[model samples]
Target: MPAPRIKICGVTQAATLHACIAARADYVGFNFCPPSPRFLSLPAARDLGAQANGRITRVGLFVDADPATIAEAVEAAGLDAIQLHGSEAPQTVAALKARHGLPVWKVISVSGAADLAPAARYAQAADLVLLDAKTPKGALAGGLGLKFDWTLLAAWRPSGPWGLAGGLNPANVAEAVRVTGAPLVDTASGVETAPGVKDMDLIAAFCQAARS
Candidate 1:
């Protein structure tokens, strides 16, 4: 099988953003969700996004943010894509795609096989459907280092483009791809030493492992 594409998310600093580019990450995600430790202000995102614009794909991560807020971030950051991590309806995803004229990725919080059902709803609305582990009620949506059963995806096939996230790290990402045959893989907290603290070595290791 071809090596999976890699996305390094929750990047907060210029050095880390440059590390991701040097590491050949396919995409770099900037968190727009206020509650997450990796959240980026508009100014921070713009600076990082400028550095990432041509060298790597820049994706803005949001969680049920109002369209106006999202619009501001997209414009400020020159986002190439928008990734939704909330309970947005298909219409919301479609509308965002129409509004921004960019690829929209919908994250599905998977706990069981039933959770996979939501991907079908986003077939046309989303450019990519990302499967992430489900967090507890009142907790942050993702980037918690929580992992789900990768085997749960063994028998499933998605109609649209898709990727896998949730507790993927340098040590285990190869196994994750082997088990699920994921075409793309994403990581946020997995490459971090602490909450929102990205480790350069970990970032390099993750990229190498995901492609290995």
Candidate 2:
């Protein structure tokens, strides 16, 4: 089998970005959600993205942000893709992609088989889909450091590429891939020493484990 694609999200620091690139991560995600501890200012995200060059993909993560905000971040950060981690309607996804001309990744929180139904709607509008663990109501949208049943994704197949996320770490990533057979995986709090602090060693180990 091919190596599993690794996307390290919630990156704020230049060193952490460097760590991810050095680790051969397939994608690096920058949080634009102000509520997230890993959030980055537009200027900071732009600087970090410049550092990435063409070595890895730069993804901008947002939650129910307006078009103006999304446009500003995408221009300022030079993002290659936008990750929508909210209750954005399919129309919103279509508008964002059409207006910005950037690929869109729609994240749907799945807790059960019923949750998978939403992917079909998103797949029609999004360039990719991210199946993540649902955060409880009145909580932060993502990066809550939680995990759901991997079996929930065993039978999931999307029209476009998809990724598995939530509560994935170096220790369990191999098993997570084994169970889901996901071609791509994303990590945020799982690789952090704290809410916003990334552990370089953990990042490297995660990439290695996911590939091995």
Best by lDDT: 1
How high is the CA lDDT of each candidate model?
0.95, 0.91
Q: What does the lDDT come to for candidate 1?
A: 0.95
For model 2, residues 51-133, the per-residue Cα lDDT tens digits are 88687899999999999999888888889999999989999999998998999999989889999899999778999899999
- lDDT at 141 for candidate 1? 92
Task: Enumerate residue pairs that collide in model 1.
Answer: none
TM-score of every candidate relative to the true structure: 0.99, 0.97
Model 1 misplacement above 4 A: none
Q: Give the per-residue Cα lDDT of candidate 1 at 131.
A: 97
TM-score of 1: 0.99
**How many pairs of residues in model 2 come into backbone collision?**
0
